[model samples]
Target: MTQGGEAAQHARDEGDDGDDAPATLPELYAAHRLGLVRLALLLVDDLETAQDVVQDAFAGLHARSRRLLPDPDRALAYLRVSVVNASRSALRRRRTARGYVPPHEPPGDSPEARAVLAEEHREVLDAVRALAPRQREVLVLRYWSGLDEAGIAETLGISRGAVKSTASRALDAVEKALEAKR
Candidate 1:
């Protein structure tokens, strides 16, 4: 069979890769986009920055889709790693920007929905910002990005035991901070 014929037969035999049916890059993006965005938001503590981070991740994923994973499950894993890296990059950039004039706050008194979202957004952002950098990164990768300890460790370049301990410590710290804030 020609290459095209083989690809067609494989596609048919695979039945769209079964439950893993993210047949195209766009399909993969659609399935995981919102969750990835939210994970990035929690990691970076800024929604606009989160969107940018997710965007960069998607771009990277698109470029490497063919070589990164033959199966959708693994592609999702690749996307998760991309998001984590992009979010960390955004955090570094924000650190550099901190030396400039104080960051501007969004104006208050918009529609009711906007007002409510703004309040909740600030609360979550504050809670995340209270975490130590390593703790925050571990927590976001494990819980927010839905990565297992091994995956988190691999992504963060730490050991699995370290990921577990740091995640436990991070959760304790976050709870304490929230409790104290009350």
Candidate 2:
């Protein structure tokens, strides 16, 4: 162990490094998780990515700590740094993976992208994701895939009339969802 590590070990062995600090992993996680996630969210701009960054930060600390952090408060500082670095890495990965589109996302072809950039497409994307699975499947197949009702029915294993109804209903639901958001 390094000199700092030896000192931290000695502090832990002596117990009570003062101020009623958390000495265990669970306690540390409980104390700092919310703040860490918020920090990550500010950097990453998405709750899921922020949560992932925090989790990864904790996991990295765990990997090195050998099941017990020698100094939990110092470990929290380490975790804050790790979360920041991990969020940067996440943004870089997202930038490099520009081709990846999540399911149910309407394609952002240049013209449509420009059109919706004026109107906030997040509402539409959220509406699509909120759709029922069958409805979503029908809508994507019919519109994005440029399939006819019969083709969508064939693909989704439903009757043509069912496909027509599902698509109509899905479109109505998406409209309602967007309207509600507005």
Q: Give the TM-score of each candidate.
A: 0.45, 0.45
Candidate 2 residues lying further than 4 Å off, grouped into runs, are 1-15, 99-182
Residue-level lDDT of model 2, residues 53-163, one tens digit each, is 999998988887854487676798889999999999999999989977768976657987777775667777789889999999998897789999889988988999999
Displacement of residue 165 (Cα, Å) in model 2 is 68
Q: What is the Cα-based TM-score of model 1?
A: 0.45
Clashing pairs in 2: none
Clashes of 1: 0
Candidate 1 residue lDDT tens string, 127-152: 77888899999988877899999999
**Index of the highest-TM-score prediction:** 1
Candidate 1's error at 56, in angstroms?
Answer: 1.0
Candidate 1 residue pairs that clash: none
lDDT of 2: 0.87
For candidate 2, give the lDDT of residue 176: 94
